[model samples]
Target: MPFVEMSISLEGVSILLKIMVTGKVVAVGNFSRYIEDSRKEAIELISKLLGVTIEEAEEEVNITKGLTVRKAWLKTWWSPNWKSKPFTYPPVQCTERAFLLYLLSYTLFVDKSGSRVSIALLKLLENLDDVGNYAWGATALAYLYCQLGSATRVEVLQIVRYLTLFEGWVYEHFELRFATSNAKYMDQLQPRVSRWIQKHETVNVGDKLA
Candidate 1:
């Protein structure tokens, strides 16, 4: 996700995405068009994914969202041995899909609150095989651009986007002459972030935004 220099209009995103930036918001495919489900269906899917009963899923959803809107908390509820881990009774394929959904929520489509995520996204992840075919990168880029625009407001407090992509783009496009070289960095397979992140140290991307 490297960002090249587009000195005039910052139009490098088209080159990076390999598609023209359309005024109609990405002209990729007819994906995610009909990916909608009822709250009851989402709750049932969560129950299956987390190996919990519908009652427990409903309760957790209430606790996380204060009501059963299309959002769920991700912080304390889903991390550190989250109680609703996918059970072994379902197929391992189910577990894989659950993990993939969680991973996407935590990374690409992460919320600015850093705690809750839209349950609407789960519908998009319902079909595991077709997940890769969606214009996920384009969606992420669009969301990131939107967030960037909103962040320019005078009353803005915080900004949230795929900072990994931002930082990776910086690392790839610029020379890190002042930064320390990573001894364990693998030139072939490792991401650019590996050169900056130290082992056993968690870096918060938001804290250093200034």
Candidate 2:
């Protein structure tokens, strides 16, 4: 929520896209089906990316996050604790794509299940140079907006879009006294979200609305 404004403009949405695509998408396709069918190959590529063996990759799919979620876990790709592997050339590109995959999953296009991500997205990373070719900001806006609309139904229990933009918009447009101000905000030249501490998230409810 730090820098994203969620305005109805590319300028705002582009901040969300900065995680990569400087993009990935989900849809019905034969290519996507092919990617799903080749999940083992992906796990193999992931083993190389993580500097682990195939059996280790299978085990890592559960052990890394400690969540036991029975899904594809991407933390090693993005977490700070993991050490970098020494790769000559091609495998390094695989590492970069894996990191992008984590960013995309954890941020914009995160699966509702949280730790899992669709293998189909890996197809986009096959050509790293072309990932940025699409209008990712626009695409994310559309995707988020669609999910938000669907969430308005009475039967809907949750909204799946990136909530940071919406949270930042609320804080920016209205005076929310719950959040602590970041004194060096202007000096940091970060997003408007940098202006406040996230302490507001846990502040107890009261009659105070702002």
Candidate 3:
């Protein structure tokens, strides 16, 4: 679905907001409120749009709630003095696979767009799992590249290779130390990294063997 921008008056001032609407269902920026206010309407809308049963729509709504909670936990986790106050924000543990599926549904199916995952979600995932694990990083990268929509097939393959071999480890081990650190370096380096990966993959094995 396309993002629809609307202007509203608040206290005689104009504020512009972007919302995702599928059919008659509108998902405003405040997801929680939208869910609370239009729970039934949303479920009906989702079921009609996606051709899913109401039960499945309910499940998707629940998964979205989990995503919201996890996002909040991540903000606390990445905050200053997080270690000193480990209990400041308790973790909300759900099946990582479930979260991933919900993320795909929310971004692709519901939003119907390839916008980057919210920063809160990204930070949460980066810290939630072990780097050696492929699910979190791989899924995140795939979503990112999907949003970018400009990566070549070779570039995608290279990014997969790079993440599988190196990037995940760096994030898990070193990047979490500082709150305001270069946490988004990989995103910034995406273009250059894709180029490097493409070049590296194009080399002929026969030439090397010769």
Candidate maximizing lDDT: 2
Per-residue lDDT tens digits of candidate 1, residues 1-210?
444563312244333223223332323222222233454565776676545579976776666543222323333233434436552344555555555555665555666656655555656555566555565555657777788888899999888766555554555577776545578866444444555543333333211110
Lowest summed lDDT across 10 adjacent residues in model 2 is found at 201-210
List, in order, the clash count of every candidate structure. Answer: 0, 1, 0
Evaluate model 3: give its TM-score.
0.22
Instruction: List, residue by residue over 97-143, the lDDT tens digit for candidate 2.
Output: 66666656655565467666654555556667766655555655677
Candidate 3 on 1-210: residue-level lDDT in tens? 111223111210110101111122112333245445555655554444333467955776576552232222223333435345434322333234224424433432223222222222322233334322323223333344453454465554332211211222233334343323333434322321221222122211111111
User: What lDDT is reached at residue 66 by model 1?
Assistant: 31
Per-residue error for 131 in candidate 1, Å, reads 1.6
Task: Provide the overall lDDT of each model, using Cα atoms, as 2-decimal numbers.
Answer: 0.51, 0.52, 0.31
Candidate 2 stretches with Cα past 4 Å from truth are 1-7, 15-72, 77-90, 186-189, 199-210
